[model samples]
Target: LHSYTKYNTWDTILSWINSIASSNPSLVSKQVIGNTFEGRPMTLLKLGKSSGTTKPSIFLDCGIHAREWISPAFCQWFVKEALETYGSDSQMTSLLDQMDVYVLPVINIDGYEYSHTTNRMWRKTRSKLSGSSCLGADPNRNFDAGWCTVGASSNPCSETFCGSTPESEIEVKHVADFIRKNKSSIKAYLTIHSYSQLLLFPYSYSYNLAADHSELMSVAQGASAALTSLYGTRYTSGPGASTIYLAAGGSDDWAYDLGVKYSYTFELRDTGYHGFLLPESQIKPTCEETMLAVKYIAAHVVFSQ
Candidate 1:
């Protein structure tokens, strides 16, 4: 059995997804949003009590960058924590009772698998382009928001290659389509990434602030505070372009453009000493502290709705 505190291979994660949902029928269910370039099923785990209707939900996805193993680790940890603490942890209890959390545990399945087995630093999807020898596009830059305009590359071989076009990668299209279909009910969009220890909101394509800038900043500040409270691990909170580098076509920006106002991207864990190679020994603490920030955001979404 794969432990939630450690990184697991795609096969192990796939099995874990099936087993976890099957074991907790009432609290969780799996949805196959779409398949990847390698035809691996991209499964989504829905976490919430049986509400008999589609309630307001938060969409959280991880592993968009194949090299960020901690990203997927946090997703699995979030689900495990939510399930294990639902009734015991009042915040988690209330969040589940009132709102659903849709989690895509691993977005770049092929790339992630490749990273584990071939190269530890592989960071893009594994799709073969029609005319170029390049294998994949940066899934983060494959969205429709200000795509390939800034901080992204036009060359197919570049690490930050923004696909041939927005949603050119099947994985990106799959996620975009699902969010579009549930845009009305998804109150928040949170995409997990690693090594920066920062929380950012949209407008990455430009210096312009999101329409709900102040509110998003406030929520991110609160979540950052919540995260810091657990272990004094600091996280800078601000707009993406200004807080970090400007990255176009990110899912957070795209979802925000689609009207999911509370869109945020979390660059998790240590500043840079570890980078994408975050240790398994730190997984527990990282996930535990991250849980606080995530719960804070989820609680805000549940009550704000």
Candidate 2:
């Protein structure tokens, strides 16, 4: 039930997280960053070969949109591979030994549970709105970066509704606070989403290129190439607004503005044939190829710094 091939419910994922952390005490440990809207603990799994002193790390999160099940599956698969390949896989070994990887398997836990039981297409947090019948805001569009601008909606019933204010969703605030506190040691920020094979960088809120735009572009191209090498899954890489659409208030853009220079957003798998309902059969291959791209980006962060 908790295998990488299939999407697990919140309960199963919680159990899996507990088992993994308990079994691999040295390689992995759980930190409760904060609780979700429905009070489910937002557990962050910090993975590294423990050292007495602090080390630079990369922060990665998935399932910002509840219906994107494959996103969370990748996070779980990444942890499994990191633990299983240590000492044998040189790149992974060096990655874990050199720096830590903070993985939040599912950020929107309450909405995720609602998606599983109530609505298969639900795409926001499950928090209730003050004066409206609608519930939840798009967590991706709930960040403080150009919040509610351009691509986001102000209507509470809209799918892309930006909250009343930045970090209006408690889940978004918790993650934002964590990143703000660790900005110095965090080298890169990676947020996973689905239904589009794209790798994007900062300034999704506007058309302006980032200060490190050239380097970010080069790294993204390399990562995309690496991903294509495995299973021939191609990905287009560029700035979010220009490449895809004018999406504002995204985590990647916010993190980039916050000084995490190597920030990126990975839109995985098919371009939209399966959409959010990506099948379990594609999980292994999807994760395998995505791992190549992620490693490529992480390696750049490790060596280039």
Candidate 3:
């Protein structure tokens, strides 16, 4: 059992994924989707009851921004809980029986390492953009939804830099490519971020609403209610741009645009007392409530299908 009491390094997290997959051969497996600019492997954990045919899937990726340590912790905790409770927990059992989950535990491995070793607040990929002195671009802003417009910055040094072009960050590109390739099978896209308890959907790039706005809002409201019922962790659920900021090129919006109607962005935990430095003590409770919210969405996906 990997304790959620401490933040592990990139290598240690990878080890946990590989070890869990090996130990639970029938329930979980992993694949190296792509490599970061610093040569770190971007691994995805595939969780499901072994079945030959494809099932509807929900893709949950965490730690896209490096400083948000708790995001990756949730991913690890969710995986452990999913495997441990598959037989005992009714919701998890039914979810695994009817659907599959693919989790990218640490998407920005290079930047995560940098946050641990050098800067304690690094939030971008470590990729050195050509002809620029700045070392990285915000992976969130590197998606194709709105490219380098609106809330995104054009300067490479800015924290919200959208990069030279869409899909400029290799990490973002890897996720986009994988989702694009698996778009048909994937019914939901859940990307986890932090420092604000929000359950957001598409149209972060524009004020316009998603085509499936009504259904998405209904499900998100139900999931948010489920999450709050656990620990009273209140989450405002709505469109990303309106609920949060107008940050464009988000993976949530991109995935929604790619035809994954259930795309969501979960800004988890505190509204900013701890910010990116969320303590290890809060990990278990956070993960517990978050699991409820995630399962709620999963149930909705399964039932609706």
Tens digits of per-residue lDDT for model 2, 256-300: 989999999999988889989999999999999999999999999
lDDT of 1 by residue, 1-305 (tens): 69987899999999999999999999999999999999999999999998888889999999999999999999999999999998999999999999889999999999999999999999999999989998899999999999899999989999999989899999999999999999889999999999899999988999998889998999999999999998999999999999998989899999999999999999998899999999999999999999999989888888887
What lDDT does candidate 1 reach at residue 34? 96
Scanning candidate 1 in windows of ten residues, the lowest lDDT window is 296-305
* Candidates ranked by lDDT: 2, 1, 3
How much is the lDDT of residue 158 in candidate 1? 98
Model 1: CA > 4 A from native: none
- Weakest lDDT window of 10 consecutive positions for candidate 2: 1-10
What tens digits encode model 3's per-residue C-alpha lDDT throughout 257-291? 88998998998888899988888999888999999
Candidate lDDT (C-alpha), each: 0.94, 0.94, 0.90
Task: Evaluate model 3: give its lDDT.
Answer: 0.90
- TM per candidate: 0.99, 0.99, 0.98
Off by over 4 Å in 3: none
TM-score of 2: 0.99
Q: When superposed on Cα atoms, how far off is each prediction in RMSD?
A: 0.7, 0.7, 1.1
